[model samples]
Target: MMLTRRTITRGPFFWLSVSSGIVIMAFILLPLIQLFVAPSVEMLRVSIQDKDVAHSIWLSIYTAALAALISFFFGTPLAYLLARHDFKGKRIVEGIIDLPIAIPHPVVGIAILGVAGKNHVFGQLLAELGIRVMGSVTGIVTVLTFVALPFYLDAAKAGFEAVSPRLEKVSRSLGASMFSTFFRITFPLAWRSMLVGLIMSSARAIGEFGAVVIVAYHPMIAPVLIYERFEAYGLKYSQPVAVWLVLISLILFFLLRILTLRKTVEQ
Candidate 1:
């Protein structure tokens, strides 16, 4: 009798849970659907043909890819160290790495400007060397990197942690050097997570506007361009560009998802 009563109550709870999930999914997807449908097909086509829009899209992709590459090269070592070591102040170090995530993105842009603006020390030095950061592609990449670092770093750290130390130890015991063991064993096992991190970092960088706009507004990325169009013209002009950006993002995201899933199944 108790079991029968419990089963009857469980049905209601299960339906309630499913209803809540459906509501949340609709809430999240509705905006995206509107973005796609609100713009006419003709407007989307014309927006994509605009030279400035095309250039901004290309610039966003290029700079974001460069930022992700830089993060992958430098952050991976740190992630490995954080995962494997028990050093003093490790928590503090990790906190510092994650601090950017907690800070307002515009503040990050301002902070970066203070350190890397034309009159600042590093900025002055770089200017002397003829490398402009403020109002240049370099600045865009710099701001993107600053804001996107934590995502990739945390993902990589988690990936490395997921790898079994025992496998690395075995590789080392077989006369493999540490570097060889990591590349041959640890990295391979952990690469899928790292790739996911890279995709997320690149996506975040591409979508970043607050920081990038503050740093370099001339060679505009897509987000900055969308804002400029909205403020200068109106939603009629901006919506089309926004729709393009969303379509591009969604396409890339799904491609990466498919690739990641395939790799996971193979492994």
Candidate 2:
């Protein structure tokens, strides 16, 4: 048997690593960099001032925020359960949670429409109640929440699992109730991961287009607006709004990352 140590750091393995990293950097970073190329001060000023663009931007933020909040409210309990218990169909439940990610957006739109469109059972019932999902804000929020939930749920599950069960037991023994233990100990410790999930869910919700367009095309979100502008006016018009969306998303995403980092440090 023989062993050899390479003296050159830039050998085959090192070059391979460098090439892979460059490929990723090109794919991920280049497109993002492209967003900043156009939209001069005047163009951006005009884009922001445009009523349709403003409406779409506001709608995107509003729906994405609502979706993230909904995820936070519902996903917390699901996270706790998946972390604290084991049972038959656990994997099935997980797969279901992730189904939206794997499923085509158009299919998701069709499924939602089938159940909630004007002629469908729930849609008719809701119509009587003066609530319509088709071509409305409600539909927009519903689809965003449906598609973005897995991001929050998966992240929250991982966070809760990271929490030590022994600590929870100690809290119980010291007279803390289950709810108290979760709020006072587990939640605070898991906040970082939860924050990460919030960002991911928000991002997904804000960027959703295909599903949203099928269900509610009247009220345009950023992605839909981008598509509309591109189709109607051409790339020049669409590029400005696209640039704005990228900038806003990047800002909020980094803010979430910073908040999570701070929470981790405090913990």
Candidate 3:
């Protein structure tokens, strides 16, 4: 004669929540499923064999990897500093770090162009040194690093924050140097999250289009190539490339999920 909490949770509100969740999930997933399914096996085969597609995919992969590496080397120290210290203007610094993510992609491209275009100071300096930013792999990697750096930085900061300061203090008390303490104790504890962040940043770099297209239109990465094909030819020409990119993204995402799950299990 009495309804318990569990029984109450199964009422109309519960069903509504379930239905809404399903609809949201379907909204996100259906387009991806359609993209993967739309391309025929032969079409996928041909797209894979196409040199331009292959090259673009490779370019995306390697440039993204390079971007992730850059983020790791530079962003890690900043992340550790942010996590361990309280300083004046720290909030402003954090905002600056995150500003790229809030900016529109096309605007980011324009901003980078303004700073790094051949006529710009840094651009001119690089040019004098026989290096180019516009329309080169270096430019692509530069923009990729700009847009993707925040992901790794934020993740690494969170990871470092989660690690206890006491551990480092204990190591210091035991006669370890600051650098040795971090490398031996702190870094290993935080490495998994850093790895996840690197993967996410790499994925973001691989998919980046607007900024990268402005920086390096030639030697296209996969996303720019997809946009180019769609603009020049049509859906039919672009769909195969889209499908290929989607497949690779799915694979990368799947691996990310597996790593995350394993990390969870280990923790």
Candidate 4:
């Protein structure tokens, strides 16, 4: 009778959803919680002070920022077009943009290697320009750009979609050029989503490891550094670096949530 009454009050679907969400949240939060507590404060302090650890973290941030900037400049026009126009094969273009997220990270590394190889025309061109994509900072940045692009593109497209096109048309009808209208109207309205996307893309780039390790193992980023430390000296050495990465990632996630909430409220 009590179970039936409760189900009648809110429905079984509601109860099931609540339970499922609790389970998923626990699964996600448990490991991070354990990791945060596992390292001694002294160990974390020592890791923070380590020059290599510091360098690796800085490298990760630097490369991710570069990748984000590249995506912003190269992707914005495409993102805007996708949001505002309809054309043949547009879905195909979107699928290609999103393909990176679906492919395996190591496979991504190998594919990059093939394109950047000395025998390939594109690779030869890069070589002629004195750009080495293997075992260099350039390789790391390239790998990050490949892996992180889709997030920025998706966020940008969604943001632009949220903006009403009637306003843009009205601006153009009032004697504004397409460029002026885009910057003053469409872009201003969509900047929040673009900014969120940029940070999210950078955050994704910061956590990349498998491809970077396969390409540029030197000048290591934080994730690759964490892996190397774990392999060489075990968790005692790796945990501290992981702690710092998690802390930084958490901050990014928090900002994403705040922006997401604001976007929702605006809608």
Candidate 5:
């Protein structure tokens, strides 16, 4: 009986799964591990003190955070609409939302350029308002928002879906307005998921490179700096900045995992 149980517990499929998992995990971790250790302690310290590098990192974080914030305010209602309603073009709308992920990053920048061209009518209007897209902080935020919005919307939609509609109905039955009930019932339960979405969107924004590079390279977000350094001075110069980005990314990853784990437990 013991022998039979051991074979069942450690079947070929189990062994194969573990082997494949190990291989994939190692493949992903190898580069990150190598990067983290590439720069000497002294190099990292000096890089930290570099004002330009510090500013680049801060710009990346600030722009990403702003994009996520924009998603929250503008996206919440749309997310709720998608989650609760069965419209004729709902699937199409969702697909449209996912298009940013499917589109190439470089192409995203190009498309933004076309829209923001000084010759285009909309571009002229923006120009008239003194909002320049190329080589400006506004351009960077716009690109980040474009890339990050989908992540926030998807998460928020899922969050609203998980919430029971019966609660909303109850709130309404209690003589509460739809607006009042949302704040009282739906938002409270859904806020956690929305927060998780916010973090995800922010992380996505922070990592954007190709689009932001084309739109606002002068502002030099961390990824842009990494590319600039790598192009100008090779990996030796780039790796330290990369290390800092990796650290920030790791923090976001951990925080995301914690929120996800807690949400799972609560559910």
Candidate 6:
């Protein structure tokens, strides 16, 4: 009688768990499965061969990589400070850091243009330096970096926060210099999270469209090119590029995962 009653209670819970699992799997996995099934191999090949498509893909990769590098170089130190230090306006500063993530991309582009366009004071300074942001690679990278910075910063900050300050205190007590202790201890400990942040930033930069379009629509990235194709030739033409982009991005995603795993293991 006890076994029967227990089985009755567990049965509904088991089915509910199965249903929740199915919903999550369907939500995440179905779209990816469709992306593969929707495009023909020949269509994907042709898309890759298309000159404009090829250019967009290459540009996307180049710009995304550059943005990620910039984020890592500048963000690492800032992340450590934010994670380790407490000061006035700290909350405000953190909120500002996250503003990019919350604001609309088009709005970000508009803001960048307002501050950095040739006529504005900052923009005029840049103009004097013979650097134009209106319709150039600089503009694209600017927008990409602006939009993607928060990802790296936030992830790195979290990673740094997770490291016990006691460890640093102990290292200091042992007579190691601050710089030496950071290099030997803190950096190695937070390296994996930094890598994760970089991967996320790169992915965000690569997929950026609204801001890139508003900033520089000429030297198209894959997302822009995909949009243009859809506008010009409709779904049939665009789907090939879409499929190609998805496949290429997925490959990159996996490579980053492997890199992250290797880095994690090494540390």
Name the candidate that leads on lDDT.
5
lDDT, candidate 2, residue 257? Answer: 78
Cα lDDT tens digits, model 4, 1-267, are 134554356779878877888899999999889999999999999998999999998898899999999999999999999999999999999999999999999988889999998979999999999999999999999999999999999999998999899999999999999999999999899999999999989998989988888888898889988999999999878999999988988888899999889878977
Residue pairs with backbone overlap in model 4: none
- All candidates' lDDT scores? 0.88, 0.90, 0.90, 0.92, 0.93, 0.88
Candidate 1 residue pairs in backbone clash: none
Any runs in candidate 5 off by more than 4 Å, and if so which? 1-9
Clash count, one per candidate? 0, 0, 0, 0, 0, 0
lDDT of 5 by residue, 8-61 (tens): 677798788878988999999999999988899999999989999999999989
Model 3, span 1-267: residue lDDT tens: 233567465879887887898899999999888887888999999998999999999888999999999999999999999999999999999999999899988778788888876778887887889987778898889899999999999999999998999999999999999999999999999998899899899888888998888778898899999999999999888999988887787777888899889988987
Root-mean-square deviation per candidate: 3.8, 4.0, 3.1, 3.1, 2.8, 4.2
> For model 5, how many clashes?
0
Order candidates by TM-score, high to low.
5, 3, 4, 2, 1, 6
Clashing residue pairs found in predicted model 5: none
How many backbone overlaps does candidate 2 show?
A: 0
Q: Is candidate 1 or candidate 4 better by TM-score?
A: 4
Worst 10 residues of 2 by lDDT: 1-10
Q: Least accurate stretch of 10 residues (summed lDDT) in model 5?
A: 1-10
**Top candidate (TM-score):** 5
Q: Per-residue lDDT of 1-267 in model 2, one digit per residue for the tens?
A: 122556656679877887888899899878767767766879988999999999999999999989999999999999889999999999999999999999999788889999987778888898889988889999999999999999999999999999999999999999999999989999888988898999899998988998999999988888999999999999889998998888789878898878877876876
Worst 10 residues of 1 by lDDT: 1-10
Q: How close is every model to the real structure, measured as TM-score? A: 0.91, 0.92, 0.95, 0.93, 0.96, 0.88
